[model samples]
Target: MKTYDAIVIGAGPGGYPCAIRLAQLKQKTLCIEKESPGGVCLNWGCIPSKALIGAAHLYHKAKDADSMGIRVGSVEVDPEKLQDWKEGIVKRLTGGVRGLLKGNGADLMMGSARITGPRQVEVTQADGTVETIEATKGIVIATGSNTIELPSFKFDGKQIIGAKEAVSLREIPKRLLVIGGGIIGLELGMVYQSFGSELTVVEALPDLLTGIDPECTKIVERRLLKRGATIHKNAKASGYERLADGSISVKIDQDGKQITANVDVVLVAIGMRPNSRELGLEQVGVKVDQRGFVPADKFCRTNVPSIYAVGDVSGVPMLAHKATKEGEIAAEVIAGHKAEKDWVAIPSAVFTDPEIATVGLSEAEAKEKGIEILVGKFPFSALGKAMAMNETEGFVKIIADKTTKQVLGVHMVGPEVSAMISEAALALEMAAFLEDVSLTVHPHPTLGEAFMEAAAHAMGSAIHILNR
Candidate 1:
């Protein structure tokens, strides 16, 4: 049996970072992966999707540049060329991951791994050769998650599909019907919508992007509606049928009424389920929750001290950055350093049109907790930068404590709000008061000035906008 100090499974955003950090800590670390390095986030979920989104955004902007005084004869989209460019990016990033692991002194193993004992792992290589390895220190499980496929609408990888197929479509569908209205569904749906596909969204909840600020969601929803897309809220897609002409007829149940939508493709982006099964975790006495997530404490330790779990397999939020942070913390803990999952807040960004990003508590959440709060808002419509870009559609909102004037949350939905959110995250992490941000000088004619303005509005001293 081969022995090592630590073994990390699944070379994803979580696992690769943990392995690299452990090796840097001078531990004999081995990272095992059954698929290509960088996992789904780089290959399918995050990177590729963003590539498509960026391309679609550029195309959309070009088509509507007449108002900007830019006149072009014609515009066209070459799906094959776009896909080739996206694949090139994926190839470079995944290759870099491989090089980084080797450079960081982490052993890379290509195989499917299963824990056979408290410290023993059995790896089955591609050639059917099995090797048993022992981790003298610990084993970190970061298998991540997989897209949930509905039984009623199995993936054909053509007509009906999940996010993986959605991002790789060579030819844009003429009409697209999205089954869910969550982050994945809306983001991808809007991408295709920008490509001139007739888009229809079916959401089971009362509103789109549930759990997010409703005002922010409304702007995105309004944009879709203005673009000739159909949105059905409080609805469910029961099943789908394949027509003779190679089209999909989706059956939906909305408010006790049955309706049918015929389209070229149907995307079911309901959610992702943790990849926690068939890894021999049950046999080794590691507890997996009912939802298939591995529960870990502050130190990322499982109930069994020799085992640890991180990333999508560990819990909610299921974000890549969150997983990376947890991976580093776990590595530090295993390396004899004191580290825990201690953070004030995790910021979330939705890449929908006029992107929505939020950090810390929302106004509704604060009120639900019986906490008195003060709210401030500044619209992009009033900002010079947004007017210059001709993409003014959303606003920035700040929520703070009424008594202490401490900043509780910052939410934004506007142009490049995704990039502007890091400042809000830092403010929350440092427990900054509303005045802390309001008093700070921000450069003129920038989208970020909205944050400072919103903070001032919350404190009843806004310059650009009137206080409520």
Candidate 2:
């Protein structure tokens, strides 16, 4: 009968951070994991997929070497080799996560944990052995989510696959059908499309990257089309059937028109739901929503005083950063410290051919909320770096309150905007004003200057482009 000051379930981004912070606070913290430490983000979701995306980007650059004054012969991509590289990165990161937990003095238990009582948990080890542990202080559940699948088009892990399998596909199918236009679908589609696969994306939303700026999407969609990828918006995947030759016939309903496409593989990236059920939450009187999410307060505390839930198991906007933030807040609360969760900006990044990054409220959201705002935009075409790199296909736009001059949102669709969004997120978190950003001198010949320029535009003090 082992006892600890606090117990953290799941070893994903959120859970591991919570456990480490708790242990650092000198609390006897125990972390239980059913699988690897890095969870989906490192193992299957963000890391590995980004590796593949990087490889794909390199391949695209290589294909365009002629325009770059380089005479390179035709090159072909080996999906298996790419998979090996992606796997190596995953292994390295996962090892780092494990070391971080162990170094922080957090006891790591490799098993599945389930709540049996308010302060008790049962663990099922790999060898079918069961053990019970008691937590004197509190418990945190951070188990992440899995890919959502339609009942009709179930994943077989071969032909029909989730984002996990799609990341490590052994072969790049000749023709790939991606069902869903969400982040996962486009990221993976870009990977395969670069590897010589005829790619088609079917999204149920009327516009790709729903709720994003239509102008930004126009640039990305144009680029995708030029790269030989077909996009079908306002489309729903009905069903699929296997052919005699092992190919799949995918049926899609696009704006009430039925169309069939044949492909070697189909990826379902619709969305993800919380992984909160069957954890014996009912035994401990933990309440879960109909969608299997454990409702939590701003500090990640559930209805029960001593119980907390973080990560995908909590609800929407199930981002790894969000989970980690919640984890830190919960750990501090459990350590008897006064802490609060306050985030004015949570940036969203889409790693398509031309990346899309946004922080704070979108223009549509601001308008819907009845907030009077001034929008400013600076196209990458006017950027020196974008012209030099020949990647001038997007813009950076900033939205600010007209009266207060407070920056409300920052959106970008261009090269490496993902890395540039940290400034926007930090600025919003610190309650930055339009004048604050506009007067902040940005370095010349950088993409970030676009943000400063947009800020200037928002204030009607634009040096470049006509004064509105």
Candidate 3:
């Protein structure tokens, strides 16, 4: 039996970073993976999807370059080449992850792992070789999540598919019907929509991107509608049928009214469920929640003190950055350092047409909690950079406490808001007041200036826009 100080299973955004940090903390860490090094986020989901989104965005820009006085003769899309380029990026990043793990002194093992005991793991390698490893200190369960498949519309991998296949399409579908108007669905649906697919979205909820700021979602929704895409809210995709001509007719139920949408592809991106089954967690006496997530405390420790869980397998806000942070905290805790899952906010970004990024409490959430608030908003149209880029579509919103003037949240929907959200997260983390950001001098004519201006607006002292 091989023995180590700590063992991390899954090797995902959560597990790899945990293993690396453990090794960096001078712990003998063994990291095990059943698939590619970077897991779904790198190999299938985030990185690949973002590559496609970028390509689609550039293609749209190039096609509409005539307005910019740059007349392009022809715009062509080579789907095969685009996929190859995206795969190249995935390969490079996964390779880097492997190199980083090895360089950080973490032993990487390619195998499927099962918890046999509180401190014991049984690993089965590709060649059918089995080995039992022992962890003296801790065992971290970072097995992320899998896309939830609706039984009504099974994944055929071609006509009907999940996010995995959605990102790897060889050719753009002429007509695409997307079920579930959440992040993954809209992001990919917009990519193909930009690629000339007639897009239709069916969302079960009353609104799109549920739990996000509705005002921010409205901007993206309006853009989709302007581009000839149809959106059905409070709707459910009841079933789908494949026709003789290789087209699919999807039946949608919205407000008790039946509607049919025929398309070349159907993407079911409702949500993801934690991958927690058959890990032998029960055998080790680790308690898993009813939703299949392993419950972990602030220190990322499970009911069994020797075991821990992080990332999607642990709880909600199933984001890669959140997983990485938890992984680092777990590693620190295992190294006898004082670290816990303590943060003011866990920021989120939706890579829609015009990205939506948010940090801390939303205006509705604050109101729901019975807290009086002051809200400030600045449109991207007011920003010179947005006008220069010809992408003036959304706005930046800042929410603060009415009494304390403390920055409660920052929500943005505009170009590059994904990258611009870090400053908002920092403000929330530092508990910055409205004046703290308002008084700071931001670079002139930048998109980020909107944040400063929004803060100033909250205090009724905005310069560019009239304070209401």
**lDDT (C-alpha, whole model) for all candidates:** 0.94, 0.90, 0.95
1-468, model 3: which lDDT tens digit per residue?
Answer: 999999999889999999999999999999999998998899999999999999999999999999999988889888999999999999999999999999999999999999999999999999999999999999999999999999998998998899999999999999999999999999999999999999999999999999999999999999999999999999999998889998988999988899999999999999999999989999879998899999999999999999999999999999999999999999999999999999999999999999999999998899999989999999999889999999999999999999999999999999999999999999999999999999989997789999999999998999889999
lDDT of 1 by residue, 83-110 (tens): 9999999999999999999999999999
Q: Once superposed on the true structure, which residue ranges of model 1 sit more than 4 Å away at CA?
A: none
- For model 2, the stretches where C-alpha displacement exceeds 4 angstroms are none
TM-score of 3: 0.99
Candidate 3 residue 438 Cα shift, in angstroms, is 0.8
Report the C-alpha lDDT of model 2 over 1-468, residue by residue, as the tens digit.
999999999999889999999999999999999999888999999899889888888888888888979878978888778788889999999999889989999999899899998888899999999999999989999998988988988889999999989998988899999988877888889889888899999998888877778878888888889989988888888998889999999999987789999999999999898889779997788999999999999878888878899989988788898889889988999999987677876788889989999888888999999999999988898888889888888999999998999988999999999999999998898899999999999998898999999999887897876658
What TM-scores do the predictions have? 0.99, 0.98, 0.99
Task: Give the deviation of candidate 2 from the true structure as CA RMSD.
Answer: 1.2
Off by over 4 Å in 3: none
Q: How many clashing pairs does model 2 include?
A: 0
- Candidate that scores best on lDDT: 3
What count of clashes does model 3 give? 0
Two-way lDDT contest, 1 vs 3, winner: 3
